[model samples]
Target: MLKIKNLYVSINKNLIIKGLNLKIKKGEIHIIMGPNGSGKSTLSYIIAGKPKYKIEDGEILFNNKIINNLKPDKISKLGIFLSFQNPVEIDGLSMYNFIKSFIKKKNNNNILKNIYKKCEKLNINKKYLSRYFNLGFSGGEKKKNEILQMLILKPKLTILDEIDSGLDIDSLKNILNNIKQYINKKKKKRSLLIITHYTNIINYIKPNFVHIIYDGKIIKSGNKKLIKKIEKYGYNKFIN
Candidate 1:
């Protein structure tokens, strides 16, 4: 569903991603792990078509079309959803208002019902529905809210950046299980790309592939066994 070939990216004339390559097929879940400054987040943003990052070389293809220069909104319209690492708070926009505006469905009642159902599954308080989006929400609550948006949109490719960071054990398990069920239900046309430093998520949703990204490039790629190697030896074993 997504392919990156020798992608070199830079911001403010400073190079970041260098010769990075990755491919994610439909129905597959890929995990990317790396230390700070490894360009993992940059790669995610690049795929989502975030502006200002110059694609110095190579290309990004989505569903057989080159998306290297498409705007973020256009990319999103092409069935890509990016769950931010730090979800921003909209000061005056109520969650209900935001959802109503963002979702393109014509049936308001059906949208509301689906939103409420997902909110209930994510343990989002009914009161939050009327409050400003993400305003004064705890880290976990914000994360859950991101998941809620994902559930409602049902994008073709979901890119979750560090979603497990602030989640507690129960929240993490619950959220991951929901994601697992979503992927299973739409396996033929859905795909997931997760950027995380934690391995606990593996217990809830097993990844089809694990990749170690370092210094702006994917250094190693393998199946679940790679997770064990990363757990035992750390990124040092994969570096250099």
Candidate 2:
């Protein structure tokens, strides 16, 4: 579903991700872990197609089409979703209108039922539908809101950036469980690219591939066993 080859990205001429290559075919979860400034978030933003971060070289192929030069909106239209590490609060935008507007723009004939189901799965109170989008929401509430978006959108590929950072245990469980539910019920591959530091998140979602990135490059790649090593020894052990 997603392939990023030899990606070299820079923001205002400062390089972030260098020589990064990764692939996500289908029915797979990939976790990207690295120390700060090691290009984890940079890779996420690069694949998300954010305009500011220029792709100096390489190509991002989504569903086999070159998307390196495409705008973020166009990327989303092609069924790619990025759940931000910190969801911004839009004071004037009601969640109801914001979600419905997005769905309408997708122009998919059938999405309403799944939308409400998503809200319910994320434990977002129906009343929250009337509230401003993320405005003054607690940290966990904000995380739940992101999951709510993920569930509703049901994009082909969901790139979650530190989604577990601010969420409490209960909220985290709900969000993770809902993701599994979405996969099982939909029977869609729905590739997940999770960028996180917490092994607890991985415990809930089994990743087919685990990649260790450091110093702006993929230092190592392995399977679920790598998660255990990280949990047992931490990134410090992997540095050497």
Candidate 3:
């Protein structure tokens, strides 16, 4: 569903991603694990078309179409969903209206019911729906909010950046379980690209591929076994 060919990206001429190549096929789950300052989040931002970064060279292809210059709104409209690591809190906008704005089709009772059901599953209070988006929400609450948004949108390709970061054990299990159900609800492959540092995530979702990224490049690629190795030996073992 997504392909990056020798991607080189920079911010203010400071290189972040260098020669990074990755391809995530339809109906697959791919996880990227790396240390801090390793360009993991930078790669996710680049794919989602966050405007700050400059693509020095290479291409970002979504479903065979080059999307190197597509705007963030354009990318979202094309069925790409990115769940932010730190969800922004818009104090003036209610969560209900914020979500409504993203709905391309007409909003109706069915949509409202579906949203409420998702909130129930995420343990979100229905009253929060009327409050400002993410405002005064705890870290775990913010993460759950992101998951709720993903469920409502039902995008074709889901890119979750550090989704496991702030969540507690129980909350993490709840959210990941919901995400797995989302991925399996449709017969067609709804691709997933997860960027995380925690190995605990693999305990819930079995990824098709796991990659180790270091120094702005993916240094190794393997399966769940790689995660075990990282747990046993840590990231430095793969640095060479």
lDDT of 2 by residue, 1-240 (tens): 898899888888988888889999887889998888899988888888888898888898998999998888899989888999888889899988888887755544345556667777788787887899999888888888888887767788889999898888888888888877776665556788999988777669988899999987898899989988988888888889
**Tens digits of lDDT, candidate 1, 1-240:** 999999999999999999998999999999999999999999989999989799999999999999999999899989999999999999999999888887988798898888888988988888899999999999999999999989988899999999999889999988898888899997889999999999767888889999999989999999978988889999998895
Model 1 error, position 97 (Å)? 0.6
Candidate 2: which pairs clash? none
Worst 10 residues of 2 by lDDT: 104-113
- Pull out the clashing pairs in model 3: 27-189
- Candidate 1 vs. truth: CA RMSD? 0.9
| TM-score to native of every candidate shown | 0.98, 0.93, 0.97
Give lDDT: candidate 1, residue 51.
94
**The 10-residue segment with the lowest total lDDT in model 3:** 102-111
Global fold similarity of model 2 (TM-score): 0.93
lDDT of candidates 1 onward, in order: 0.92, 0.85, 0.92
Kindly give the number of clashing pairs for every candidate: 0, 0, 1
Give the alpha carbon lDDT tens digit for every residue of 37-58 in model 3: 9999999888889999999999
